[model samples]
Target: MAVLPVCQDCCQIVTVNKNGKIETHSPEPYGERACNASGLLTGRVRDIVVSSALRAHAVRRSRPTTSWGPVRVHKSGLLPRMPDAAPDAMPAPKWLPHLKGGTLASVTLPAAGWLGVWLPGYAKPTQAYRVEALTQRNVTSAWSARMECWTVNNQHFLSVANALMRRHEKILVGREYNPREKCTSSCKAARGPLCTCSCHAKHHGGGRWMAGWCVAEEFGTVVDGSRWHWMITGKA
Candidate 1:
């Protein structure tokens, strides 16, 4: 079922469902009652107009809403529009320890300092041991080559040379787009895929339909998994 949100401007019922459908429903006769969708969790905005008191209770969706019968978006903010963490840089710590798989029950970082973790295949920790929690802060351990490196919310240290490890990595974190940070209003990105700052939102076009926040590589090359957030579009 779709989640319908109430609109304040024209007293319309709008909805942005989980199925990715955005539309507005019929409304009570104008001056008949009150229309106020004051606090609702909806998209940015959309303009709605009532064509006829008859169809006033009708429903519509997101198209070129610029022109529609007598219906009009008298108020601008009332338009029901549709749409919709970066970490440190450095090598794995050295003294983070090497657990081949001991009492690895939970997945939490062991120490809070700079540490290098070598589980087995990948340089990450979780992949190596059932338990995980390895971060990087050591600036003196020397940077390690990003060979067979795959980073996601968690770090798996499975061996790349092992078939199981490669397949497992692909299934676990084999995504093309990586998340870095949330795009705030102060962000400097125009809506669309042209964004090169590696910005992203909770939805597809972003919460702000007008502002874009994603920057892929320019050469259409695969980036280091850890840098996935910065990979948005192929360069010009």
Candidate 2:
């Protein structure tokens, strides 16, 4: 518990007891020890130092080793969560038809056969139609045979997906379609709202866009344009 002095001649150290009696042999002659030596390094001091060191070590170990592990990132709801494949993972539209009757904006696969197609400006189904956007704009009657009218944009699509997911509904995934930058406007006579087009010229050449499917349910209306907005109604 004493801080002994080094010898000036031999440069060695020596330890002494309280009565000025040399306790350990060394080449150095240390100073005499006093009665009270509580502040000097002793058992309690060693224990405290060891405990502090151990605590610091434990705290360091408790932290995450790497910042790359389990990272939390915020994501935009509109964009579909594509896999980590090549940028051009989806090939050309060899399966989709080149029909000109109406611009089938989106064909989502809610499951199988549960396709939600959006056609803005002008699309008149010659046969039956069975779909309606929760946000049907000016349509007075709900078209049981055909979709009245609907508009969708990138943001609106994401909004609808979020709403449907919250409602515990599966997204209808349509057949893959290239996105088109230009969108057609459905007429006032049509049953739906002003539809927006998902047209990316460079990616999807012939006015095509990737389509996500959804079930036709009364949840909400999504405005399609450069800035999409979702107006939630009932149990969205």
Candidate 3:
């Protein structure tokens, strides 16, 4: 590689080979120094540079892109993981009826022909039903149905939809109505934790808070003001 000396008066360039033989003589000299021989402008060096640039461009196009940031790749699990959110930050969900893991307050008929309803508390169900919560105080019998209560509590709050199947119905699905929130009370009912409401039945505007539904689109509970807790039916 060589940079020629320009004739300052006429701006003409002169090049010389390693043997001091005049290789190139220019009438119009370049304002800047010439590039490395066989590079930048033409030859195998130029082809290599162009090839590398094209490869980088193809890579950019091939990958999945997002405005939010880089794409995350991970092995999926059998059960979908939930979306993470901050505590107490209840921004109206992009989709609704917000969901969370809660305690099963009751499994009741409430009326004559209503499908059995499961009332889950926002607070994780505990054996300490007698904990002076000032709501279900009196006529004791805290936990009625011990229907497969998990000592390992369910998720607190979460979101979904990313990597969800394009079809709507397949993504958002539900299991049996029995969320089975923990219950440590000693109400031993022979029939799988199924019972009628008694103690906590008449708290607050209990009727207004009951808004649970069943798998068959059956309108489930109808009460509203049970002070314990209110969460979504059918965990996502």
Candidate 4:
């Protein structure tokens, strides 16, 4: 004899024999009535059957969609091999060099007033800055019609430089190369022993001078003082 699942509505036990016969036992007086009302005997178990079907359908729908068909397991492993690593999980290349000792610019200002400096050309000033820069620094640049130049706050020099670096990284996403090797078209054109291309300049210490020049133009040769002013101005 084999035991079937217990009735959900009532504590009823059902057993089936090899001779194609079924026997039901009710634990409570109302068990038989509850089973009958549920149409268990008449094979009209609508609620139970429909709920199971709906659950199966939901599970099927919830599975992630992919171009490939259903996965087949093999004795070795999965059919479509999993990647060793994901793109985002890879380590980011070092781009900017550490700051050295010096003030960014050569200028004098009142203890409270803001200093103005022209934006550097290599910084690739843009009308719309990246969201990272805007949210982190709240740094904004202005175009001076009289001077015909773009100017930013003296304190926002580093933030702007960082934003430019990020932008350049995004632009040259797939073109990443080993710094010691000539990888880009520009590097090949220059016929250099090492990567002397724009990508190299943007990522390596080669462009640090430009960054320092921009800083000097904006904040002057007073790194600690400029940083202190930035903190006091509520912009830090």
TM per model? 0.15, 0.18, 0.16, 0.19
User: After superposition on all CA atoms, what RMSD does each candidate show versus the true structure?
Assistant: 21.3, 28.9, 27.2, 26.7
lDDT of 3 at 90: 22
The residue-level lDDT of candidate 4 at 206 comes to: 38
Backbone clash total, candidate 2: 38
In every candidate, how many clashes are there? 32, 38, 12, 5
lDDT of 1 at 51: 57
Per-residue lDDT of candidate 3, residues 56-165 (tens digit): 33211111111222212122211111221223222221211122421222222222222221222212233233122312334223322333221111111011111112
Whole-model lDDT values for every prediction: 0.28, 0.26, 0.23, 0.28
Cα error, candidate 1, residue 227 (Å): 16
Local distance difference test, candidate 4: 0.28
Model 3 whole-model lDDT (C-alpha atoms): 0.23
Score candidate 2 by TM-score against the native. 0.18
Please write out the lDDT profile of model 1 over residues 1-236, one tens digit for every residue.
23334444443555544543333332233221112222233442354555566554464332222122222221211222111001222232232212232110111111122212232222233343321223233212222343322232222212211222221111111122334455555454344322223343224344353232222222122443333221111111
Which window of 10 residues has the lowest lDDT sum in candidate 1?
102-111
> Which whole-number lDDT from 0 to 100 does residue 100 have in model 4?
28
